[model samples]
Target: MKRQFAVIGLGRFGGSVCCALIEQGMEVLAIDQDEARVNKYRDLVTHAVVADATDEQALKHLGIRNFEHVIIAIGDNIQASILTTLILDELGVEHITVKAQNDYHEKVLTKIGAERIVHPERDMGVRLAHHLLSKNVLDYLELSDKHSIIEIIASTKMSGKTLMKLDVRAKFGCNVMAIKRGREIIVSPQATQLIKEEDILIVIGADEDIKRFEHEMFDE
Candidate 1:
């Protein structure tokens, strides 16, 4: 059977999610308050409707509870977003993901029982800032407010050292989860594995510990 999804609010984030789900061959019901926005995705998705999601009756009319997953991507109006999420929770929707505007918005959504909350803009900004901070830092993913997983390009100082020799966990309290060399990736690399220049090291630890590891291993 085909997977079913409903995306409410056809803004950049919602529109992108709708298109991506449709591309994956999932049936997507695209909802928006703007007629023009709904019309734009009408042909691209399984269904498109202009409806006020804040109204419980309209949501029931759309059979929203039947969908396995629903995304609330309302733009700008935090009040509307919170109200819509609360109604969906009360309606017994199994999974609800809401795009949060800020920390306070996320807190409200959590209380409303949204299964997942995303801060796309804020996350992207944090990732970009990490990229700017160090040339060796290839990418970063925030696991929580204080911890993250980061990809760092191995430097000359680290090129010939084995994992056992580096003693990263003992020295810096960070774990090297994997090593990416060329097209190959080594998961849970053995302590004897040799580090090579340009290898991508996937490390996970608290933000402060990661900073310390980077400074001690890579900085001059």
Candidate 2:
């Protein structure tokens, strides 16, 4: 079944979400106060309208309650975002996701019953910082405060060594879940599969262990 979504605020973040949902074959109602932004996405989404999202009457008139999910992507307007979320919750929208500017904003949204909160800028900063700090670290995704999944480039120390030989699970407490080379990806890489330079290893483990493995397995 196709899911229905309503995205309020047609800034870059909200616009991107609207486009992505449309690409995934979902019905999207794009709303914004900016006439230019709404006009830009008029043909891109199932419906595009210029309105004040903070107004409960405007939201109800647009049948926002019928949507399976509502995304509040209002940028730089905490009052607007908070008011929109509150109105959505009052209208009994099933799921609400909000983009928060900071920790304080996130907490406020959570308290108001937002189902999920995202800090895109903070997340991107973390990913970039991790990659810059570690030569072999290609990507880093935070699963929780204590756990993460990372992609690391296989280095000389790991070249010619098999999973069993390295004993990553025992030594570093990290699991090498997959190996990627060029366009090919190997899931559950065999214990005997020799690691080669330039192979990207997808690893999952506790945060501390992942850091330890990166520092110990790769030469800086």
Candidate 3:
């Protein structure tokens, strides 16, 4: 079944989400106060409209509550985002995800019952910092503050070692969830699978343990 989405605020963040959802074959209603932004995405989404999201009547007229998920991506205007989220919650929208400008904004959204909150800038910064600090780490995603999924290049020392020999789970408290080499990907790689140099290992574990594994596996 195709899920319906309503994206309010046609800023960079919201616009990207709208486009991505459309690409995935989901129905999207793109809303923005700026006419130009709405026009830009008019053909891309199922519907595009220029309206202030903080206006409850405008939202109601658009049948926003019918959407499975609504993303509040109002940039800069924290007040507008909060008010819009509050109205969506009141209207019983099934799920609401909000983009927060800061900690205070996130707290306000949490109090108002936003289902999820994203800090895109903060997350990007963390990923970039990790990549710069560690040559082996290609990408990092925070599942929580404590746990993460990381992609790292297989080190020379691990080139011929298998999962059973490394004892990753028992020794480092990490798991190699997948292995990617060139165009091939192996999901739930076997215990006997060898780690070849240049192969990318997708590892998941607590943040501390992941860091420890990185240091031990790829110390330079």
Instruction: Please report, as a residue range, the 10-residue window in candidate 2 with the lowest summed lDDT.
Output: 211-220
- Those runs of model 1 whose alpha carbons end farther than 4 Å from true positions after fitting are none
Overall lDDT per candidate, in order of appearance: 0.96, 0.94, 0.94
Can you write out model 2's per-residue Cα lDDT over 144-209, one digit (the tens) per residue?
A: 879999999999999989999999999999999999988999999989988888999999999999
Model 1: per-residue Cα lDDT over 1-220, one tens digit each: 9999999999999999998998899999999999999999999999999999999999999999999999999999999999999999999999999999999999989998899999989999999998998899989999998999999999998999999999999999999999999999999999999999999999999999999999999896
Task: Give the candidate number with the greatest TM-score.
Answer: 3
Top lDDT model: 1
lDDT of prediction 3: 0.94
Task: Assess every candidate by TM-score.
Answer: 0.93, 0.94, 0.98
Candidates 1 and 2 compared: the better one by lDDT is 1
C-alpha lDDT of residue 187 in model 3: 97
For model 2, the superposed segments whose C-alpha errors exceed 4 Å read: none
- Itemize residue pairs with steric clashes in candidate 2: none
